[model samples]
Target: MKNLKIALSLLILISVTSCDDFLSEKPDNRTEIDTPAKISELLVQAYPQMSYFDIAETMSDNVFDSGMPETLRKNEQSYNWDIQTETTDIDTQAYYWDACYTAIAHANKALEAIEDLGSPASLNPQKGEALIARAYSHFMLVSLWSKRYNPATAASDLGIPYVTKPETELVTKYKRNTVKEVFDFIEKDIEDGLKIVTNDYKQPKFHFNVSASKAFASRFYLIKGDWDRVLELTSDLGSKPVGKLRDFASYDLLSAVDQRLAYASSDAETNLLIVSANSIVSRSYYSNRFYLSGARYPDIFGTATSLFNKPWLYNFYSSNSSITVFLPKFYEYFKYSNVTAGIGDPYVAEVLLSNDEFFLNRIEAHVMKGNIATANDELEYFLSTRTVGYVPTDKLTEAKVVAKYPVIADEYTPFYTMTPVQTSYVKAIAETRRRDFIHEGMRWFDVKRFNIVVNHETTNKPVNTLVKDDNRRAIQIPLHASNTGVELNPR
Candidate 1:
């Protein structure tokens, strides 16, 4: 591992790397990352520590003016579809941008260390994890900071810098890659990682385990309109997805706090990958000026909104003033720096990938592939667990799903074409996803992919509508990154 030592020596010579301090002066200076064990330890930081829930959720159609007096700059900016100015806050868009790159820096460092260790077969797991981690961070970055992937114009759309190599210089100038280039880079990393990725981590749920990696692949292909690949990636989850899906029914048996704690627990088979993120999103659920309001709560989770006409198993809670409403999904844990002073950070255990979401992705793939009956059957079984008082004898047919989600012309106009029936099924799946991941920020991806319109209203202000193909759909690149020569999105 002489090469590794030399690399470490060079790292020591450098100060903080990147304009945003994405890399430290010496990441592993305390101990050499010469061994596979050390590389694995380093991989723990490969996932973004900051949560994008607040930024994304506020921008989606799921929220409205709660009439709450509390306000966070990030929340207000996101709700109004404006560029965020809160660059240093834990839950702001800029913080998440830097956090994603920071995660990528760690992955690149581990990959470099692994290469220096001779790229032995013994370190395949670490190599696989590092590659997938790098891909995931870049994928998130491009998905947020760039326009939605449109094959016809991806070559021209500005993407976030896809950093793959460890930084050795104090300050590295980076240029934004094209959307097509970023997607190409991400796809290459994912395919390579999948070949050798394993589920052998001490805590598989915290790392890019086999299932989580496959879930990510399915998500990527689904967005790219590669229906066949999406199905191939999620095939193992089965058509029924009986035990692999979330047990929402059982969550009702637990206390509210317990449900929040168990939502991201490794014990839950549905949770494929979870990470502790520096976030105040849980607190924001009930405190933000704009959030899921009591008036709009029924529009999403009410019994009439369900296909089976049953109440959702999701538990809802109200703020002290009953203005804001939220699901018991996020659990915040305080990490005390000084126990006596009660000063520290708020962390939320976030489920980045899950069997439930993967299963929905598979169903969408089926719908896109013209397997209407199969998609209907799978969607039926998948929703059963989440629907209260679900009757086993009741069958969900394609006709019924289509009838429920009628094709409103131009409601969803993605790059790929969809038949009327396919459009209905896709709409059904998107709605399910919207309900399933209410406060998790997953809806924002669907909003972009489907070109869904979001009408956000505030007290005494005219309705702010994010219409289809709006330029604001793509969040602007962080001002600091733009100042450093990275391209900002067109307003």
Candidate 2:
């Protein structure tokens, strides 16, 4: 207990002192004399910090893809399963947790400083942007530290502490809030944010634009099952004057495949916010040099082998003796640049948040409400645009596919029956999303969200189950948070 207390004291002291470098810098008249711009710069710092929460490094590669060796094509696991910890490496979790809190603390500092500056109206858009950034930081922290958003269970589940002010004193203890409270707070922040940050601005390549803020809100709405709001916000996304996906044939597959992908690449017209390559490269460097290299089990494919070695497999490989196995999607996405590239454009491909996803979300709601026909039509519409050569009216029936290509899944299951249209929709969404997003960090979330049973297609058998409440679902809360008396999610 004494040692723990001492450690906590040190942690708080470190947190407070870490920002001294920035704080110590000579303040220009703008920062010292003016209030709003200083707050805006603080908010800007908060935005780039989110790129530190890389889904690939922390969640996808560490958790969802960890099991791919046995389930996917050609890989081997030399270490016993016991060697695998929950969600991510202990060190990795610590790093992410620290990064998140650091961001939160920075935002908190801005908010704290702004409070003394004057009334909220005095700061205008800057105050709103600061709040938005703080809320986003908290949202990311809780999403990683807590379980999936289950409106039913969230009221009871533990969430990260909602710290609103910078802690200057040493050894401040905190406790968890319920997930419901966390999300409620996040929603309130977004509402507040929406009111202030109305104009678009072009600044550093790494900062969040106004459209990106809306995109984040759109994502939040989608996750919360607010279909109307999602549709309303995403409706104007792909229209003229915004952005669109590049034509499939026009994609420079070779060059684009291995490069570190930002939110928007050069070809993208509507990507709202993309993490810069510097952030990616820095994180990737840490992951490759430390975490991946130190992993106990050999990759299934072979260490040091690229995931694109066979794009069809979509799994890791082992080199004969190397410690690293290339993620094909990661490789493909960042193929154009080397490790040291600076931040790229935020728009890569206008991530069409499409009416399709909205349609599917509505179908899901309808299925939950037992409206079968409406669900089926909506499902069909979503599938039609997804499958390239097919017309929008092409039926997605099992019989049609079985008749056309003898090699598809066995018996045709109707959209109703024991194989619920909901199930079909989930599968369709998963498969289509997997193909479309590739390395964009959406696949693993699909696996977790739907509790999908991943199977080894080569072996024609169920491989493993990834669901909430499973060990696979719980990432270790950063040691710093845990040490500070913050309650972590149960495994």
Candidate 3:
């Protein structure tokens, strides 16, 4: 009993130890972290310390000028593809470079502390989480500052520094690795973590419980083009009588605002993990709902001469749903928060992983492997939740989904200047992701992985446009870390 009490007390201290503090200096050697229980406290924070989506969100096609105020200047510049927008000085949004490494540092410390504990079976769970946490952090870091992992060019492309040791002095100086090396390290960590991780966690949703860790692994394999591994991981989920998709119809959709909040609720069955990021209150685009047509904002449904002219292009929220006309559609602002989000969002970002993502991941894998029948079944299972009155029993087809959820419609278009979109199963997946994971910045990862060129425009007489790619795709390393030899990505 006394030992449990001591471990809990150490954990509280660990939780309060901000990532910044850990990065700024080394831990005192005298502090006792040698025991498994004490080491578990450090592993409690295996998740990324910050929100992972903002800058990438601005760089994607999901957002538009929408006439809403940009809470921060960086958001506007980012959306415009201004080369100098995300300087180290602007700390408004979560900085991927620092946040990711900080997470790695925590994981490394946990592993190092438990090294001499002999990694007995009793200590496997802690060791598993630490290893997985380390891999997840590096995966996020390389995903952003470095280019997407492409085998052909990865051998030559520069990757983010992959930190392994918990020692601060070692982390203080580092060099970039090839993209392939970062991916190899991530894979190795997952293997090591999976071997030790237990399927059961006391707080399953808060940590990477058995199912959640599998889900994370499935995500990684999908990106690596390993369809068989994805299928193997999801084999159990495939035959379950009730797939893990959230039954949106079961929610009170009669009230759109209430429903949006309900979908993102803490206890919502859709969530596998729950984490909240601070809402950047200053950025208008971050919380905007305005979409203009001509000099005046247009109504969702046209009346009289032009009847029933509704815009279509797979946006999360429609004009009618967002009560605050200028607020971003699809988000439910039940309350306000004061925390800053260079890490993640306060309430909305908390619903990071869910059954919805798993279903989509399986569907994509099935499609890639040419199992169209299986893929269709999974897709139908998913649409039942998102589309009102959708019947999953009927055999659904790719054509049906594309028709019902077309990105472009006859009468109205979104406020952005768009290039032609291809109609394929992949596009279908991207559109579904944009809707299912809106506002949370989940769509940006797909944008980078596929190198989807998104163009943004200013509503001026001449109409300025920025075609985003190249240097804009990668983030610049923060100046704080620059003195220590971490090379900044070309911006």
Candidate 4:
């Protein structure tokens, strides 16, 4: 159901001691240790932690768009503004951090209770599941709230606390571990969990499974730019037949509710990790905006008239007036309901890492190693698959891309084409990545990684905004962590 509220309630019940008072205080019936069933129930509490996924996705996109008013959303789009110094107070970052830790605590409690079950031979599959789940929750926490791992800086950089126990001990003071240590702990846990959890459990339709762990590994390797490991993990995924990519061009925007909903509900072949739609908005955000006539373009979803109005059908005067109409970005992803619903679950698409991305990575590696022809071939492969119209050659030298997208080149000065082979390769890979994962929370990270200059209208003027070295890169660590002696990342 991807129901986040249920997830939150269950988490609080299992991990927090304050709620223990609500339990019946019959002295004779009270037990010092948790029963197996009780522990299993606690493990179930981890479900709501997926809410962090929705929060991360929305905040990453909505907070960065210029179309939304600052007053209406209030620094939601702006990152690391001086006025909001206490990073912990930021809703998006705070919510994600809290949700992840809560889930981790529940997993820890489950594992501790399993050990207390005594005989190792009697251990249940649920115990291993809990271990893997805890490790994954922690992995996401570090990636989202902290800086990218650098061995040199990791010892000084604060990572989330590695709470392996329920912390029932009174006066238990927690401390943050180094980023490197945290990742090391996570990797070890995953390895240990893999040993215990066999591929025998009936696959839960909307929960984490063994394959999901592999998917996570693939993503982790990709983030670290470990091309060989990325290839290995993704190849493992390709061996298992799962899902397929949906052709975006085939969807009809103006259809009946049931028809539209059916199309929306259909999962894209490549959808890897998603939170459940039922856990977030009640209906599609775009659909609601369109129906209410509250849509705007290049901002939130645009106005309904701007969306459906046909300029060719109108008179010359009316057509001239309609030229100013702008299409909304929201409609690009959310035109259907099914797609919205499948937000939280670990989907197959994420596991099937793109062949295009793989070649791009290979090309980049070659360029770095000074293998010119190999790099050029990889670059051509990527660009050829990107569009149906154009086919690039191995010998295609870098030239100004002014012929295509002439308006952008004309409007913007010094708009150079792919001048260097390395530049061409980077651009080709980045563009493919963007098109492949539109709402998957990869764009802003890409913007930062490539150090791309963001040229867009701030207040309807062509303003060139450089996001490089921006304070917005590191999200504010949660206040709860800070209060508990966990150090915050530098703002």
Candidate 1 Cα lDDT to native: 0.85
Order the candidate numbers by lDDT, best to worst.
1, 3, 2, 4
Please give each candidate's TM-score.
0.94, 0.63, 0.77, 0.61
Top of the candidates by lDDT: 1
lDDT: worst 10-residue window of model 2: 1-10
Per-residue lDDT over 110-202 for candidate 3, one digit per residue giving the tens place of the 0 to 100 score: 787777777677887888888887888888777767776677788788887887886645345888988899899989988878776775666
TM-score, candidate number 4? 0.61
**Positional deviation of residue 103's Cα in model 2 after best superposition, in angstroms:** 1.8
The TM-score obtained by model 3 is: 0.77
Candidate 2 global lDDT: 0.46
Candidates in order: C-alpha RMSD to true structure: 8.3, 11.4, 9.2, 10.4
Per-residue lDDT tens digits of candidate 4, residues 388-422?
33423323333422221123321221112233444
Best by TM-score: 1
- Stretches off by above 4 angstroms in model 1 are 1-22, 26-32
What are the clash counts of all predictions, listed in order? 0, 29, 22, 19
Off by over 4 Å in 4: 1-41, 47-91, 118-128, 169-173, 195-205, 237-243, 246-269, 272-274, 277-423, 448-457, 460-467
Model 4 CA lDDT for position 102: 64
Better of 1 and 2 by lDDT: 1
Q: Who is ahead in lDDT, 3 or 4?
A: 3
Q: Looking at model 4, report the run of 10 residues with the lowest lDDT sum.
A: 1-10
**Candidate 2 on 1-491: residue-level lDDT in tens?**
00000010000111111232443343331133235656665665564332332343334433223322322110111011111222233223454455566666667667777778875675656666666677777776676566667777879877778877766455578888887898898898887877776454554223444555666676676567665665565555332221243233233243323222432453344344434222232223123322233243233222222111222222333332334333322221222223355322221112323323333444454544455565556555444433334454455553432232242242222212324344444454444454445434455455444443332211233444333355445455655567678765565
